[model samples]
Structure formats: C-alpha cells, structure tokens
Target: MSVSAYKRVQRDLESPRSVERRIFNRITADLETWGAAYDRAESKADRLSALKGSLQLALVDNTRLWSLLRRDLSQPENALPPELRAAIISISYTVDRITADLMSGAGTVAALVGINRPFIDGLAGISGAEG
Candidate 1:
C-alpha cells in the first residue's frame, strides 16, 4: 500500500471517534456478560456475588467511560452541542446513583438490568454496532 494510505489508516485507528467506539464496544460486552451472570444466578447470595464482582466492575467501568466522554465534551474543540453535553452529565449522575445503590444492597438485578438497557441501546446507536 502507498505511504499516504498507510498514514491514513494509522490516523483513523487513533482518531477520537475510533477510540470512543472501541470503549463503547468493550463496555457493551462487559454489560452483556454481567447481564448473563445475573440471569444465571439462582440465589440471593449468588446474585449478590455476581453483583459484587462482575456487575459492579462493569458499572464502575461504564461510569468512568462516561466521565471521560463528559470531559471530552467539555473541551472547547468538542463539536457536540451543549444539549448533548448536558444529557451526558445527567446520565453520569444517574450512573453514580445506581452504583451507590448497588453497593449499598439497595438495588435489584432487575433494576440494574433496566438501567443497563438504555445505555446499551444508546451505545449501539452511537457506535452502530448492534450492542
């Protein structure tokens, strides 16, 4: 391949959109795995164990992802509209609340599943990955 083509490929690989899509894909996979674990848990102890391990970790990772997105959106060069940034901030707040509730044993698997669906859908929409 030409040097210019190779350079273009390298740049595309490192672009912010590519990075964001990769992050989103990872988060989606984690959520799916956690969801399956939650589905298979047959007892409260089992469910709680899953929640404490994979589910909690997924939530933390997701929160961190959103935090990074919010930070990026706050930069002057970010082209996303102000309303989109505000929406991200609001979702971040919800994620924090959900994480706190889960940690405190005040959350259910159903609640967590409910919270995850919208995020998964949104990620799928943005990444066009059917996640």
Candidate 2:
C-alpha cells in the first residue's frame, strides 16, 4: 500500500476520536440489527417465544454496553463536563430500568431503541439522521 494510506490506517488505529467513532457506529449498527430482528420475529408464529430469547440476549448486551459507558463517564479524567456526564449516567439508569420492564413483558424494544438513538447521533456527529 501507499505510504499515505498506511499512515491513515495507523492514525485510525491509534486515534481515540476514530476509536470512539467506531464504537458508536458499531453500537448503532447493533441496535438497528436488533430492531430488525424484532420486526421479523413479529411476523413469525411464535414471536413471543422467539422474542423472549433473542430479546433477552440483546437487552443483556445493551445493558453491558451501558454499564461500560457509565463506568467510563464516572472516571475523573473523562474530559466531558460534569453535567453531561451526570446526564449520560442518568440515561444509562433509565435504560436499565426500561430493559427490566421489557424483560418482564411490560415494555417494548421500541423504548430501548428510541432512548439509544441520541447516543448514535451524538457520538457519530450526525446532526440529522433522517436526511
């Protein structure tokens, strides 16, 4: 490969901004995939049965991601403002609560997916996702 391309690759590997973008992109993709799965399951004969298993798995993964994000934001050197950190941590708690509700048959994946939309947009720097 050319030297310029190689240097870009090296920067992508080492730069925290790029790393954060990748993480956000990955999370967004996962949410989209899970949403699609739910949609498909709805068309099946045993949607509740299918959804229970996969939904639990997906919610568990989402909670784990939120847990990690909360841990990071709670750190002393996170660079974000205190208010923003608190807000994000608060959102994580809401996610946890909503996840519990969904697992208990009292909520829908739509709630979890909706709450996480801003994280995808804010983290990926997308001002308008609909366009």
Candidate 3:
C-alpha cells in the first residue's frame, strides 16, 4: 500500500475513543445476547457457552484495538484530545500489564477479557451462577 493509505489506517487506529467505542459496542452486544440466551437457557453449559462466547469476542476486540494502539503510538502524531490521550496512555499501561502477567504465567485468558469484569460477573449472576 502507499504511504498515504497506510497513514490513513494509522490515523483511524489512533483515535482511542473510536476504538474503545467499537470495543464497547461489541461487548454490549455480547452481553445482550448472553443475557437473552441465559434467560432461555436449556442447560448450564448453554449459559456458560454464551458467556464464553462473549468473553472470546471481548478478548478479540480489545486485543486487536490495543495492538493497534501499540502500533499507533510509535508513529508521528497530530494534536489529540486530552481525554483521548489519557485513555490511550491508560490502555497502553493496561496492555503492558496484561502482557507481563501472561508472560509470567500469573494470569489466564479469562482474566484478560476487558475492563468490565464486574459487569460481566453481574451478567453471569443473572444467568444463575458463574459456571
């Protein structure tokens, strides 16, 4: 690809709020689907499966986004919103922390889903149990 096209992709990726919003939307949809599935669940594994699916999507979306941020931070920059900058820094720290934890074998994939663990837990509770 041309430099301009690549830079355009980087610019899109650099928008922390946009990336975060997309991730949040994915998680929200997952939660909604999981909730519905839970209420209509035919088995405990069915509910757990929905939750697991949610977790998988949450991990996929956030990790891809954070990877983009890691790449974007190394590039040239224009003015960014203060809140967005802070969010990016926080996200960078979080990604680094999670990576370190994984490398150290101190965490599992279940522990690295997203920032809304409490929300997920609550959803799980509503489903019946943690399973």
Candidate 4:
C-alpha cells in the first residue's frame, strides 16, 4: 500500500468500527507489508547468496499471521461461512508447507505471494483479479 493509503487506514482505525472490519484491515495491511517485503527480497536475492534478512522476517511474520488466522477460524463463532473458513484453513496448510520449502531454498517467494494475492483482493472486495 502507498503511504497515503496506509495513513488512511490508520485514520480509519482510530474511529469506532466493527470487529470484522478491524480484522480485515489488519490482515490486509499485513499482507501488503509482506508482499512488499517478498518483492524486495526477491530482487535482492538475485545472487542466491545475497538473500535479504527481510525475507526471513517476512516468512516468520507470515507464519505467525496464519497461525492467528487459523486459530480464529477454528472458533465456533467466527462468523464466516463454514466453507470459506475451511478453504482458508486448507490454504494455511499449503502456506505451512511452502514456508518450509522456501526456508530450505526450494521454493519461490512468488508462490507465497500468489497464494496471498487472492485473499488480499477478496478482503478488499476485489474479486478474481490476477495476483
């Protein structure tokens, strides 16, 4: 997200809001941050030996975020439809597997981004646009 956009979200968050909207904003912003970090890491890692520390940080953060999401989704009163929650849980597993692969240098950051892009769009109410 642009600085202006980030600022706007911050402003929006300062006021009263629904719990669902707050969660949505936080997740979307974090994804944007992770996406930018991954993009930067990919560019910096062209030499294979020059990987950025930001990549590791982003990966760890991504895992933590998914863990939180999974825990929340598992709750009986999460409010999301069952099918959508289940699908997200399934994708979280894929993210877990891919995160391990990427840690071992056998996966691309792009894969992680591809998985997240759709969720980001969906959270923003933009359906089915290519990541």
Write one digit per residue (lDDT tens) for candidate 1, span 34-110: 85665576765666677767777887887788778768877888787889888877877777787676565455545
The residue pairs in collision within model 4 are: none
- Kindly report the root-mean-square deviation of model 1 from the true structure over all alpha carbons: 5.4
Residue 89 in candidate 3 has what lDDT? 59
Q: Write the per-residue lDDT of candidate 2 for residues 1-131, one digit (tens) a residue.
A: 99999988887676665565566556556656665555455444444454565556677778888898899999999999999999999999999998776555455667777877667666656676452
Candidate 1 regions off by >4 Å?
A: 1-14, 39-45, 108-131
- The global C-alpha lDDT for each of the candidates, from Candidate 1 onward, is 0.68, 0.71, 0.54, 0.67
The count of backbone overlaps in candidate 4 is 0
Question: By the lDDT metric, which is better: model 1 or model 3?
Answer: 1
State how far residue 108 of model 3 sits from its true place (Å).
11
Give the C-alpha miss distance for residue 100 in model 1, angstroms.
1.9
What C-alpha lDDT, on a 0 to 100 scale, does residue 41 get in candidate 3?
Answer: 54
The numbered model that scores best in TM-score is: 2
lDDT of 3 by residue, 1-131 (tens): 99999978987776555445545556556534444544455655654564455544554555665666556654557366666666765766785676454333333344444444433443344332543
What's the distance in Å from true for residue 111, model 3?
9.2
